[model samples]
Target: MDLKRRMQECDEFFRLPELAHLVPQRRRAALEQLEQTGGYLQTAEEILIGAKLAWRNHARCVGRKHWRSLKLLDARRVRSARDLAEVCWQHLQMATNGGAIQSMITVGPPRQPDGREFHIINSQLIRYAGYRNGDGTVIGDAANIRLTEFATELGWRGAGTPFDILPLLISTPDEPIQWFDIPPELAREVELEHPEFDWFAELGLRWHALPAVSNMNLEVGGMTYPLAPFNGWYLGAEIGARNLSDTNRYNMLPLIAEMMCLDTGSERNLWRDQALVELNRAVLYSFRRAGVYIVDHHTVAKQFCDHVKREEAEGRACPTDWTWINPPISSGLTPTFHRYYDPPDLDIRPNFVRRDFSGDGGI
Candidate 1:
């Protein structure tokens, strides 16, 4: 992304009444800076609002209703990998907020003119280590198998548990890849238990409290920050329906169905469907029982619909991806699944872009 060119095209950056008058001046300065150094630094206000606008413009997110509440942490001056890790650690604590789970983004340094940038290897700040065994079995989240192997190659080891927290992995232009153990206290987790199922706790299922995506690049105005980790609280279906129940991930439905004595002899019995609902119930119950912030799919879908209405009232188009904005389970039951929306526009500025996990064997 080129900041100079983006400045000329994206008027959202200068849309605020406070910044409107300075658009001409800012645009001129950005062009001058680009000619001299091939980049321009964004002001604090620009970064802050830009991050929020990015969230608002993210079509896949169902939680965009709370975009204005996003908190920003400017760490653009962080020079070393260790310093980046330290700030990321602080980001976890702040975003977790003792389970209140504040929405936040910590912007690391922008990609340099030399084409080098900082990187956070883990897709999420906290993820279960996935150990792929020689026998084709997996011990943890199957989705993270490559990441676990990458961490192990870096000399990090886990207890070989089903839900071991993976170490934070990062890399810099000048340094080799590095890993750090999240302080035990900072790695908050909620033990899963059904509110009424006495044996559910015995299943020993748990998930980390935070869902920070650390590997995406934040593209605001014309600058791209490769290490801007951001997070919000969980949407229960994300964990219950996709993470745990997905066939390739934890694959917990079969065990849970067997435990529930659900009839599995025939697809007509809808065993997987039954297990899915119960599993989602357990997840919602567990998080709420543990005082962690989480929302049920129905409620979150309603909020998204509401957000779309608000955006319409403002004469702004709310771009949305139908598949992503709808809940994975019982999507037809929500209002979000009932209507069409503006298709996602990839050209939107102040957006978060997924980082390509290639080279150096990084995942």
Candidate 2:
């Protein structure tokens, strides 16, 4: 976890405005005392600092320009299944913000001596239920088939649609996975409709307002927090090009092309390309109509370039993942595709690290 280096990072961070009180004494002694007792972020303000740094260090996210504005909720005291469920609901409500999405995170308790921590098994707080039939066909979003199967085994049922929100799955130290159905009022979804095509609304396409990633662990200082669910407003292409059009996901491009009456006989005609544009347009239009905060691919790409320029100006090399930084569609058209980044540092702390979920029978 690079304990010494992170303590030094915290030392410098506390030097920022309104934070000098944290390191009034010798930074070394304060760090040693905190590390010795495993109390890295013992206060709400300390956790807020860590959460902001975590967002800043997220290599795959291109929305670092608002890192300092991330809202952090210190839910470290929440332990039981019921409490976890309520917290998840609250996170959705707060992040959704009634259409004005806000970037936020809820830091759960750190890992225990028994190697267990409170966590949600789903990748996102809002995702479709994937149900697999015996003949290999699937219903709903295929991306979550494994989780959907697991949830079904744990007694969860969905409405059998392309946009059903999966129930919250919570696991404690030594208990079965707890299931909680999120209230419909808390999950604000955008109903996608094309501006030019009236038939598009018949597809009943929809998605949750915010993308709250729930499975990643947060590492700050020397402690490994196994359950830190964080969220940010979506980039439109994430839904149009990847989630809704990926062959293994909703696979909507071909259908949309047919509906648009584009020539599907040959790939040279770029039927898929036309469909992709319409899909992306619909996503942006719907979010805008609902007063939600969603950035288009081109805008976010330019913003990412600006973020890197600012970081480099401050004498820091920006680490990034090219595959994630590049939008799923029209990569060559965006400014972000033209640049190279420093090699990623896999050992960086105060970053979201995926936890291994194998052999977790205790749920």
Q: Name the candidate that leads on lDDT.
A: 1
Give model 2's TM-score versus the native structure: 0.92
Candidate 2 lDDT, 99-200, residue by residue in tens = 888889988888763456788888888778888778988788998888887888889888777677888888888677788888999888899998889999
**How does residue 102 of candidate 2 score in lDDT?**
88
Model 2, CA-based lDDT = 0.82
How many residue pairs clash in all the candidates, one count each? 1, 0
Which stretches of candidate 1 lie above 4 Å from their native place? 1-12, 15-18, 21-23, 360-362
| lDDT (C-alpha) at residue 193 in model 1 | 92
When summed lDDT is taken over every stretch of 10 residues in candidate 1, the lowest stretch is: 9-18
TM-score of each: 0.96, 0.92
Model 1 residue 301 CA deviation in Å: 0.8
